[model samples]
Target chain A: MDRRDFLKCSLAGCSLFLVGKGLSTPLSSSALAAPPSQLSRVEARYYQKLPDREIKCELCPRFCQLGDKERGFCGVRENQDGKYYTLVYGKVASLNVDPIEKKPFFHFLPGSEAFSLATAGCNLSCKFCQNWEISQMRPEQVRNIHLPPEAVVETAEKYNCPVIAYTYSEPVIFYEFMYDTCLLARRRGIKNVVVSAGYINPEPLADLMKVVEAIKIDLKAFTQDFYTNYVRGELQPVLKTIKQIAKSKTWLEIVYLVIPTLNDNPEDIRKMSRWLKAEIGPDYPIHFSRFHPMYLIKNLPPTPVSTLEKLREIALEEGLHYVYVGNVPGHPGEHTYCPNCGKVIIERYGYTIKKKELSGNKCRYCGQVIPGVWS
Target chain B: MKTSKVVVITARNVFSGQGLPDPRVVLKMFRKGLELLTGASKAEEALAIWFKPEDRVGIKINTIGRRLLSTLPETSITLGLWLGQTICREDNIIIWDRSNEELKDTGYKLSNTPGSLKIFGTDTRGAGYTEEPIVNRNIGSLFSRIQAELIDASISLAILKDHGLAGVTAGLKNYFGAIHNPNKYHDSHCNPYIAELFETDLIRRKHRLTILDALKVQYHRGPSYHPQWAENCKKLIFSTDPVAADAVGWKLIDELRARKGLPSLKEENREPVYLFTAEKLGLGQARLENIEIVEEEV
Candidate 1:
């Protein structure tokens, strides 16, 4: 977002924030550096204490075993004197009331406002990270507002937001803070949702699925080579997360950002669509998001609308129930259609839900049951 | 083949008991190092061989371990002051690390004197990291302005220690402190990324020296302080070839580990092959056979 847009978005009551000064220029990162006073020393979860003041983090597949003063790949958790601590426990880098559609949860709550928040630092270093200003930084390198779990719950309640979103940066990195906030938000009659890279370990993912109502996993690519060479992560763990979430009662959605000449191959999309159909079944919504020139991958052009359309067609042909093309507003792919009886069940323009013709869980036109939480 | 030279200097009585290295003896070691490395009669004349009067020299020290195990203030300041008084202007040399807090924790009083030997960190207001990242191979990191824009030449004045992750943390690994994202590079025994980071023009072009402070070496369970595994090695290794300097330092760590009946870093499967990667990049020689070791005790 630009400076003007940031100022405009700050109209949400009782909220304060500071974005990087220059919109065109990259964040000096100096602007993001939080003072020492803003730091949190909260002991972390999902880590094993090893001998001699060392630790091995099991939060993710990396399983980073660190000596004292060492940090995991995520850059938010650290091993301080043999105990693992989450430096960004309550440090919120970005907080705003965003449309649930922005998270592209077309199936889950089409038009509801979400209290979206994120902390600095992400586990995966995607070469084309869209939110690198905050995601690709240590807690000390970002300006953070100290909003404890109670404060987060209260903020969502005050804003009249039905759902709270752990998003922007990878939510799994701030699992402790997010999990605590989720528990509090749930008690207060609010729903909790997560937007993540799905890079979490099975134990943590299993635990997280029990607390959150829904999850949006950004499946970077179908290939391990893409995960390794570009995303600096493993593909199997992400696939496992999808499978686990599919087995759970919690709502699940998948987004595949198609970067030009990167992960946009037709063959990979066919394989991914077939796999999703076989494992998660045809009910789960899959989005083919358009990739822009961002972070370190600025040289490539934005994903062509033709590419998104073609991929959407491929997925649809592969028998996936609901496939949407993202990042291009007003495209037919942005709207929801009933797979049982083809009709526009929910028309959307950008983040705005233009029209909804659904009665409970079924399409109003054909009495066909379209999956998702509509209440 | 022109083999690299590594000078290992020691003073037996430099630390008879628990105290910092004796400044007088340390100065003699530095003098001998420079004279022998450059074939000069004095240290000041030796500095002229590699650095010009106009160059701003940055002595990048590893200060992550706090007071117990870090590049001590005694070694860095003494060397910075000597370089200022001899080769460059007093203000031209900056002894720096990642942050002011780490520097302070390592017993360094933050200084930003415009016309004196300065000792501070990247967090010292104007010395923060650059806005954009310098991309080279697998390394995409924002370099501290101290190493990128402020200094014309660089020195990795690193602590010699056995790293749990990198197998050894020395000259090449110390450059990790110069970047904003060292944590990202620590994967895979810090291979290729360490070498690639050192190959970045911001580092490779400016780096002029490598000095490993081995007064007290942590032979095992380190990159952290565990007195049981640490040894008072009473040594300082000097070399212009960074890979060779760290390779020699790695050999010392393994030797100490062997003496203490501990398995090698390789047996533990965390060997630092980045030196070999660095050697492949023509940064320096990694093989001991290709490096000449010169020992001295002052």
Candidate 2:
């Protein structure tokens, strides 16, 4: 069903909620009546146990070596008696039925609805995190519902959403849950997609690529200084992740949030475009998202539309195939223009797909094949 | 220049045969530590120097280690009761940590009686974190309302242990429990984040004292409880300078490590450099030569 039908069904008490401005869901009556004090205690995937009851987490580049009872930088994984456990597995903190375009996969399954959810916690702490209420919190700090992998897939099927998205907060922190749900969703003929900051290890990302169909990475910046001072992460690892995803069969899309005076350097954007063209080719789509003052970055103003347009122009000039501007409704850059005929193949306004001039992954006017999944 | 004074009060039999602290001996140590730290003949005069009678004083305890290696209830309750009896109202004295579960696991009964001593955590019904983030230098977090709004003065009654990242988890590091995102600050070996978090006005302005519970020092492979590397030091460190108290706590951990033929924290390349950062921020003295340590057996 489309988002309009989904909204009408939600209004008719369909037990599904739409994600709105707050980015949070009210606790169900059952969850509120008996709040769970304990979080999920599943064993984490990538970690090495050391001597003296200590364990080093290998999930992210941080490699947080923790003592017994100490949590990693993600705040969702902990070391208990020399064993690393992910405390957020199956703990659904936020649930929403959103449009596929909200995940901003402009090239994948346009105008369809996606069943999206996220657990509490993230590996990277961005200074301007938009979803800090859930992303920057531990599992215990947020209200959660116990939705196992089976339940997630079943809900997606019930809601008629062909794709399930691990989004909102960083999905890599909830790797186990997302991986398991992807596996389950695959068995039921459903597609899986992930939205993340891409601050993940290669091994986990490789395994994730095998199960998911598409991945959208938030490339915070091109410089290590921006990663250190603002993102609390490393740029090399994120670049590595992007390269790895591009090499794999998974469809890749990139989003660069343009902050005022932070990462809006045109030269850096030129460099990033050149690098992406050289390493990953130009078939992938890149979105220059507008950033607003949020979390700890209230000092700066919202990114100007002119800045995004300039950055988009630079990326297009660098021989990139598809580039777009995001978070700005009704901008001409929101539409997908064909590289061959230069006609707008797909028109969009925010999360809504206004029109599609495509016939079976090809431009209807010129028969130029577009690089995306069109069924 | 006058050096910061740090008082170490020791008791040989502070712990009972069952591995719990003795309340009576812990109370004696508090009395002695307060008297020596303040240069007052009595502990009541020492309490008055830091707190007013109407002040709501918060004793921020470290309970992440649970019962194995937390700031024991016997030690913190004695200090809280003493502070209540000497200066603040009984109900105004709060003994708290990050969560009610950890506090309960560490043998702290949840209490909020109107005319009695209050013991709880930041997770209490009316005591969550502040809605907005407080930005201070590189640190930005929502502080616990108990530390930010409820209490007029704070005493970091923390467990003295060797942290895997921070080199030493002591008085100043205890304030990590007061923020909502301690995990975010664990990067860069917790260097400037720990010091910067303490430099925030919610901590620096209201902080009145530092009390390190060094009765059982986890000298190696800690902030966790590893009995093989644990040592019974039977000491409580006190200082008005938050950095000096943690610096002394670090020394005591090094002393314990030396006794066990282990490398110093500096050799391990994780030397709690936040102490030096704290020193630079004018929070307190981190160098050993800049501190006057007064030791006495109670």
Chain B TM-score for the candidates in order: 0.97, 0.98
- Say which docking band candidate 2 falls in: medium
Error of 1 at B148 (Å): 0.9
The A-chain TM-scores of all the candidates are 0.93, 0.92
Global lDDT of model 1: 0.88
The local distance difference test score of each candidate is: 0.88, 0.89
Clash pairs (backbone) in predicted model 1: A32-A142, A32-A143
> Which structure among the candidates has the greatest DockQ?
1
Per-candidate TM vs. native? 0.96, 0.96
Model number with the top lDDT = 2
For candidate 2, lDDT tens digit of each residue in A105-150?
9999999888889988899999999888888888877777667787
lDDT of 2 at B297: 100
Q: Show where candidate 1 strays beyond 4 Å.
A: A1-14, A18-28, B16-18
* All DockQ scores: 0.61, 0.50
Task: Output the lDDT of residue A52, model 1.
Answer: 93
What fraction of the real A-B contacts shows up in model 1? Answer: 0.47
